[model samples]
Target: MKTYHAIQELEATGIVTAGITRRHGGVSRVPYASMNLAKHVGDDPNAVATNREIFFKQSRLTALHYCQQIHSTRVIDVDHTASATLKQHPEADALISAQTGVALGIFTADCVPIFILDVATPAIGIAHAGWRGTFAQIAVNTLTQMQTRFGTLPTNCEVHLGPSIQKCCYTVSPELLNQFTERFGSTIRKGTNLSLQTANTIQLTEMGLPVASISVSPFCTACRTDLFYSHRAEAGQTGRMLSYIQLTTKN
Candidate 1:
């Protein structure tokens, strides 16, 4: 929504609508600047509401579903029956749905946003992958959940890696690096930075997802702050962008 930058492939999908927002086009100010989507990040609630409304209107989506990302392997199922009333948003890093109208949304600053659409089954999933979430294999875990919940096959799923902090701007701890190397081997290391996008792509490919269905966004949030909000790039004082997917019936 808000005419934000988006992944062209995902945008071209006829059955599902997917997009990622940028740092432009909203009421947030100063450090958060504009188009800030997260409520807990200290932006005024009314401003966030206005931004969200603009996005919702522009995207033509139904009520959005989101979660409290704990950088873990937990994945939540969102269905047509899912309700927005919650004591708190589910604490999970990924969300999956077979339902149409409803959109699955994941917020990120510099962290990775992985979106999967099972085109054959008309279902979708979205994940928030910070280093901890990646280390927990959130992408693979989400696919596994989709398989169980929607009978989604990896071959029929299209994966999109949205703008994030790539190896050029990301550095991990030695312990973290060891864990990554053990799982994906040392080829993931590009100097001190860990290639999170590549690592997740590898994990998905190893789990039987088609190589051709995966598309990685070339924009790095930290490198393209003019079009995105980057937490690490902004010294952790920045706002967040929303990466989302929706399964909508043909009009």
Candidate 2:
């Protein structure tokens, strides 16, 4: 079974390794089923460990730096000195790094996993964008940080919005929909369903990123439970998939 879905556009750059894991090819039992890489979801520790090891081997990644993921717009910069294990990670929703050989990861079941690759600066960022994070503009904050820390320009970046519960399956409250429409304009919502993808894309484009520079995955976790784990579809009793990106040490 395939272990991951590569972010084709990012990998095409030949400077980074990027993708999200599929819910197959691992030892995780029912609910998690298989290929679950997160340890905070009540899955067996050994199972999670084995699954992560499987990803590292398959992806040829050795070092991993991930956030604790608090559903906020907090973005952290991961430098060469930063090292993190599953048990020891910072409390944030996004991570950016210019350092090679270290994978920046985010755990998500139904939230959007935003991947940013600033080719000019050779930096990478990954963010966990749930509704709250999207509302607060986490994706924009990541780009802003990249600009400040690494001299990254939005035009030099290629971005991908990984699979999550898209608008078709992500119905929100009327109040939330109004808030999104007010912030991102009315085009981002259909009735009470908000498109987190559009909300993020609008902000990114407004910040000078061309619309063509961003690619969004068509897959919806809630719609395709066979391929992904969905918190809403699974009633909060499912494992999380890991979305990660790493800069290759090779020049």
Candidate 3:
């Protein structure tokens, strides 16, 4: 599979591959615009299915496994067969797998989509973290699952925080901001701006992963409407971009 231009940092790793798709490469129009991979967002299902096919073909992934994503910290284990039945999988905010040829997918617009791959073991994980999920420590849960299921150490894992709404463009209500501060302490800042990226990083660091192994995308979906979808910028009327990663086998 040719590397996606948007996820150049992830491609540079050589060992694992990932992509944060843009809004240009699919067939959806207006509202959905293009490249809408989510089915529940009111986009045409046929368009979404075709878009998914294009994405899989472009990424060279065998199958795409997606979670229902309920803004919680639940994580599931996926294998080849599991990937095929992703439509029926329970609502989870994260997924982990040690099996090859299994692609784990997460959808996000303003929410964060994080991908983790263990260099020392054959495990991969994906997490969907909105403010709710971030405060719930979804990233930490994903790392813990990798450790427990595959015996992968946190230090051996490298994580990529895919494109999402950054703090600069992510504004929240005072009440919501206070909730974050109350739960996460100083991580939410005194102002009403809650940095979900920083919060997730701190959570992962607390789980024993080094800061150097974590790579965060600087592109904010709300700020870069030309390239990504933004739920807040569009007043919850936009489509979702998908961040996907998988362990592919050598044929």
Q: Rank the candidates by lDDT, best first.
A: 2, 1, 3
lDDT per residue for candidate 3 within 167-236, as digits (tens), equals 7877888888887777666765636577898888888888889999999898888899888899999999
**What's the CA error at residue 165 for candidate 3, in Å?**
0.8
Worst 10 residues of 2 by lDDT: 80-89
Cα TM-score of candidate 1? 0.94
Query: Comparing candidate 1 with candidate 3, which one achieves the higher lDDT?
Result: 1
Runs with alpha carbons beyond 4 Å of true place in candidate 2: 82-87
Give the TM-scores of the predictions, in the order they appear.
Answer: 0.94, 0.97, 0.92
For 122-204, candidate 2 gives per-residue lDDT tens digits of: 89999999989988999999999999999999999999999999989899999889988888899898777889999999999
Over the stretch 1-251, how does candidate 1's per-residue lDDT look in tens digits?
35477667876878877899888889888898789988879888898888888787777776688888778889888874564522125789888889877778888998899999998887899999988888778999999999998899999988999999998888878888888988899878887789899889999999899889999999999999999999888998988898988887668
lDDT of 1 at 110: 85
Worst 10 residues of 1 by lDDT: 80-89
TM-score of 3: 0.92
* Two-way TM-score contest, 2 vs 3, winner: 2
lDDT of 3: 0.82
> Model 2 TM-score?
0.97
Clashing pairs in 1: 28-33
CA displacement after TM-score superposition, residue 199 of candidate 2 (Å)? 0.4
What is the lDDT of every predicted structure here? Answer: 0.85, 0.91, 0.82
For candidate 2, list the clashing residue pairs, or say none: none
